[model samples]
Target chain A: MGYPRLSIAEIREGLRRKQFSCVEITQQHLKRIEEADARLKAFLTVTPESARARAAVLDQALAAGEPLLPLTGVPIAIKDNICTQGVRTTCGSRILSNYVAPYSATAVERLEAAGAVIVGKTNCDEFGMGSSTENSAFGPSRNPFDLERVPGGSSGGSAVAVAAGEAVGAFGSDTGGSVRTPAAFCGVYGLKPTYGRVSRYGLVAYSSSLDTIGPLARSVADLAELLQVIAGHDPRDMTSHGSAPDRYTSGLDAALRNHRVGVPFSLIEEGVEAETRRAIHRALDALERAGCAVEEIALPHLANAIDTYYLIAPCEASSNLARYDGVKYGYRSEHFSNLGEMYQITRAGGFGAEVRRRIMLGTFALSSGYYDAYFLKASKVRTLLIQDFQAAFARVNTILIPTAPTPAFKIGEKTSDPLAMYLTDVFTVPANLVGIPALSVPAGYTPDNLPVAVQLLANQFHEKALLHVAWHLEQAFALKPAALAV
Target chain B: MAITLEEVRHIARLANLQFSEEELQAFIVQFSKILEHIEQLSQVDTQGVEPTYHAVAGKIDRENARSDVIHASFLQEKALMNAPESEEGQFRVPKVIR
Candidate 1:
């Protein structure tokens, strides 16, 4: 299990220098997954035969001395919620436990076309609903740093996969901090690109407006490379934009020249753990040393984001998930006497408690008289929250905040209180609400040896500048999640 | 503004989900807390602001539909691959009337 941890950059460089064949690299990663995944429970399905088959083709191409594609021979994991043709994609839900997608998602197709080796499908909270993977029907994915602690969800497994060196890079979807929270908890890099920056063609929709597939990796360069390959418009996803992706890797080493960073002073001043506060300062100090300007800014409507999101996300999710009736695909209950009873019992037996709770909350929110008071009011607040980001970004290139209020907590810490669990995503929700791009970079480890992170966000489609500043800040902090020794 | 158990049952019927008595009791307690949390949204002055139904509200052109052109899609077999019960390329479900 002591395999060398190589970033996508290092893999390309090594492959070019004839250090090892594509099969060797893929096997090394497979070996790591085999050795560490038992404890981490990161992957729901490990496709060894297909992975080896894919690697063998790359090996043949390498023997033919072919030019390197952008992501040649790089091993990557996909979140189970994103469809993979002919692979069992459970979405960590019992409802779709046996479902095999007939076609791949646009992002998965793009990654494979770029010569990436598909390693496996990783676990997630059922249908990407919960902030912690405890809602996963298959069971929660454990944090690689500490087995007793929870890995942030619903992309927890993808984060653990990259953190444990099971894969070179991974793709996870972020609706409300699904990607960034897990990355922060696991001490890695995860980027949630601007809404419509990546297509959602074959993705199983949770909250369509907020859901976007993103990459998690051990390095910013790998994160950028993954983003570059998967970004751009698709005819299948009408919301996806048509702009060409920028050369994401071209500015990884660029200096943070004239970059003004804004922090919502009062937001972080309250309720955040002291150690987490110190970690944010550590990242800001490093950025300041590298010539970044840090200033306090106001985001008056920010505190209402969590409540606004809970209402809006569940509302959208209820509509999107209406297709899971017993007549269609997925699980069907055996206890029903009639068609209507079948629909009710199928959903009751098929969905977990949290999923049903959200659906109930959403249905109530949209019911006859409640729609105006609940959904409408929440949507107006959403507008106000969006305006808050618009006002904040006017004064700075990017906003900085702690990725989470604290490090990874014990497994059962917040599961008992869904409201308590939802509050953990307090700082990460505004970006999703405004449809902006946000990146979570590991700031440092806590005294308890858990990792904490600082988040950076840019206005819509400004990933290039955001990533440039992130790369600078990454260097200023200069730490590796591979130090996890999984 | 507390949620009654009867309303909880009504919402479950609307959502087409079934819950045991025990689960409903827990839902009443937990969901009321969540409802209380979101009640603060009404206190914010959103009088003149338009509700944002979609994050990218006007950015997408939803008025016009894609052209009525035939294209490749999942075949009946592939589409029904995951159905629990199917016959003659159609998903089978319990009879609506008996």
Candidate 2:
């Protein structure tokens, strides 16, 4: 197998055995990115020079008999929204197209400290705004499974990079299914850690309360490993939890003899496609066979998650995005009569259509005379959704559901219908709203060969349990990682 | 509730944005549809429920105060590196008043 297709564990083992040098693996993966990224359009920036330099350092360390780091010389991609020191951190928008981050995000710093090679920054919806990468200003990333279909987004490029074997793994932020949806569409493993579990110090804010940086990998083990490296408390991010990080890979192989897996059957009945539903049921059945106690559970307020998310995320987004004025950084308009005109022209010209739509929606909800009716009401419903999850977890260890209502749709299918596109996140938003850990693992393939995935969610800070269940399910299914014919 | 064209324009103004006639017309329809979808929350019985502003609200470290001390920060040149126009190590913008 080529270097690009190797898992992080395999690469680590190979490096220790001297089966391959770090430089060789890094070069091979860089070559794969050079060859495959044109058709896949998965990366916004490829750092070949920096990657080689880092790999050379690691190779010298190995020669000197130094202890190897956890992710030594493993090439990975970061979602463009995560800042990389001296790298252009575009959130897939023209506003920051030329913007170079002065500092690295905390997650990037931790990854590099662990000896990981950052090959490039992957594409996303501008500021993590959309369910599909089609909203990306750079252009949407195409699914490796089918070029006609879109890679689900705003983490689409991250998922595509891992699925196409361009990178061993990738990091993407989840604010309402951005990571998991793309992972499901690309047939990779994605984990959204509980809010506050990971530091968001340099992650460009989308929704402060909901955004989380998580991993997308070819295997569940890699997902857990990457999460271990990046999950910790940071003084810079006050919201970061002070609890010690869990050893996520510790119990990965343990049997789920008495584990409780709740299936929210009622939530999937209406909008989910028949094939997707069957795939989820089959996954649950597999879990049952593996000694998991699969049972039906109720999350009655689940139907209200989408509405609550739409209102609250936009409101927070409107506030977070207000920093992009003409003065300090990012884009500025060339012609404007006054300061007020400059602000208007710069923002109007800098942002894309979907971003503008969201900003406006948020502004309306938070505007005078309507804040109580829309934003506050949505917040109350968010509380109700959290309670529903708490109640379900009281009876079950982890909740299981379909990652997305349907598999990846055609590129332009739902772009014209804003509401329809929003509905794509119905199954995944609850985890974000409640600050719980969630994961999406490949379940099976559809008749058309598209990938379908099942989601597992655990209560807040229960990522180890969630990852344990996912690793077991992943092995039980024994599905092969996605390989592109190209 | 159906949003009026005037309301759309007002919201855009509040957001510090401007749209052409064509874009505004399209937004009118899109906003109407999205707002209609969001209207479902009105049926939820949220009576006596407290709003959750932050996902992990009570867990925030409100008392983790640092001592009053000055530390190193970004240099002036680096801070202004991404600005569209800069002079004398300061971002340049249009005058606020006539």
Candidate 3:
């Protein structure tokens, strides 16, 4: 093996045996980051000094014979949207480019507490607004599968780092398919946990109601381990659920025999490529052989998911992102003489095109005359969409669909066409809208050598069930660990 | 159903964002396309369904509000230092209505 592409388990085992110190492992990831990140643009900032210092202490603790957590010494990348203490948490916006968070996000705090060394902060869509990382003030992250194409986005950098072997695993927030879409495009495993299952405290809010922080890893087990560490309630966040029961990583090895999996017929949508269809079939066949009862079901309203998501997400985003008036912790205009001038100039200069567009849409939707016609109507539509999912889950234990309509598109393919860009999340958005847990695992690849993923959606608080299905598929469809040759 | 440039400008004003003429024209076209797509949701009949404002299933305990536990972290301290304008340890913004 080139450099021992260590999963979290393997790295933990290696650490236990003292095969490599935490500092050594961290340095290896840092070295890979330095060598690979320039071309990939996967990271916004690499905290080499902090990572080394943290890793050194873990190494010292090991020398003193102290027991370490399972994720100890494992270098992981964090999406820039998630706050890390004393580190710049930009949320991929010029607005907060210099904004350093004094306290870490609850998820980041939990992961670091479990001894996971945060290697760097990865790039993201500005304020997690775009489906593609192209909306970033930073450059778009290149797909590790094909450098010419985008590594799917919003959470593109997190997905790219894990796929490119820069980090064993990483954290990313999913709002409107940010995590799973990029994970699918980059050919990595990503999980969007049930809303309220993971604490959103310290994650710069982007649509508070729909946003979820989750993991992107090379394998299902690694994703599972990362999820276990980060999944819990936080007193700091009122929206966080306290009573949700989870033994997510435990007892998942029963092997998906005699389980029912529903394949949404709407997955074969108008724009789906022929190869993407065949890839889903191949994945289904593997599941069938493994004793899964694969059946074709119709979630008719799923076709409307993208529409409901656009209205509801932007509306929530309009409210959530209103806090960055430039009078707070971020960039402020020096030329503004009056307060209105300050707000106008600072936001205009700080925000990008997509951010501006969403803000406008959201404001319009929530405006006095339009509230009932737009935001309230969209809210009602969201309930219907959730009901559709709840009804579908009643018939099936898991819902199987394509993560993206097709595999990774060219970097600039849909940037000009906003609707085309929005349509990429057609399949992934419904899961987010319903606040159910979902996972994207590499199903197979196109003949053109790009990766396509099959997504599995489970009902609310059904993370364990969703992951069990993903892990089963991961083992069966263990396509020869291929990645772009560095 | 095409969104006009005037509508785009109106929305931009409500958002408190400044848009150039070119941006307004582009957004008029783009938002029109998005609105065209989004109009499909209205076709679905959603009578009697409870609108989901939040994702969580159960009711939050309004009776069980926790006391504010202050962390002496730099985040609180920096919130003050990072304020654009402050007076007597409070953030000062423009007066709401002139």
- Which residue pairs in model 1 clash with each other? none
* TM-score of the second chain for every model: 0.89, 0.90, 0.70
Q: lDDT of each structure? A: 0.89, 0.91, 0.85
Worst 10 residues of 3 chain A by lDDT: A1-10
Q: Candidate 1 regions off by >4 Å?
A: A480-482, B61-68
Pairs of colliding residues, candidate 3? none
**What is every candidate's C-alpha DockQ against the true complex, given to 2 decimals?**
0.68, 0.78, 0.57
User: Pick by DockQ: which candidate is best?
Assistant: 2
- Across A1-486, the per-residue lDDT of candidate 2 in tens digits comes to 453688888888999999999899889989998988899999999999999999999999999999889999899999999999999999998899998999999999999999999999999999998888998989999998999898998899999999988899999999999999999999999999999999999999999999999999988899999999999888788889887989987879988867899998877878888878987888888888888888889898999999999999999999999999877889899889999999999999999999998999999999999999999999999999999988999999999999998998999999899889999999889999999999998988888889999999999999999888998888878996555644
Q: Candidate 3: lDDT of A383?
A: 84
At residue A459, what lDDT does model 3 achieve? 87
Q: What is the TM-score of each candidate against the true structure?
A: 0.98, 0.98, 0.96
**Which residue pairs in model 2 clash with each other?**
none
Off by over 4 Å in 3: A1-4, A266-269, B59-76, B85-98
Docking class of 3: medium
**lDDT-based ranking, best first?**
2, 1, 3
lDDT of 1 by residue, A1-486 (tens): 465578887889998998988899999889889988888899999999999999899888988988888999899999999999999988888889889999999999999999999999998999999877889999999998899988899999999999888898999999999999999999999999999899998889998889989999888888899999999878788888766778888967867788899998788979899888997788788889988899998988989999999998899888887888867678888997888999898899989988888898889999999999999999899999889888888889999998899899899998889999999899888888889999999888877789988899998899988789888877777774445646
Question: What's the CA error at residue B19 for candidate 3, in Å?
Answer: 1.0
Q: Write the per-residue lDDT of candidate 2 for residues B4-98, one digit (tens) a residue.
A: 98988899989999999999989899999999989999999988999998888677765433445787989999999999889998998887767
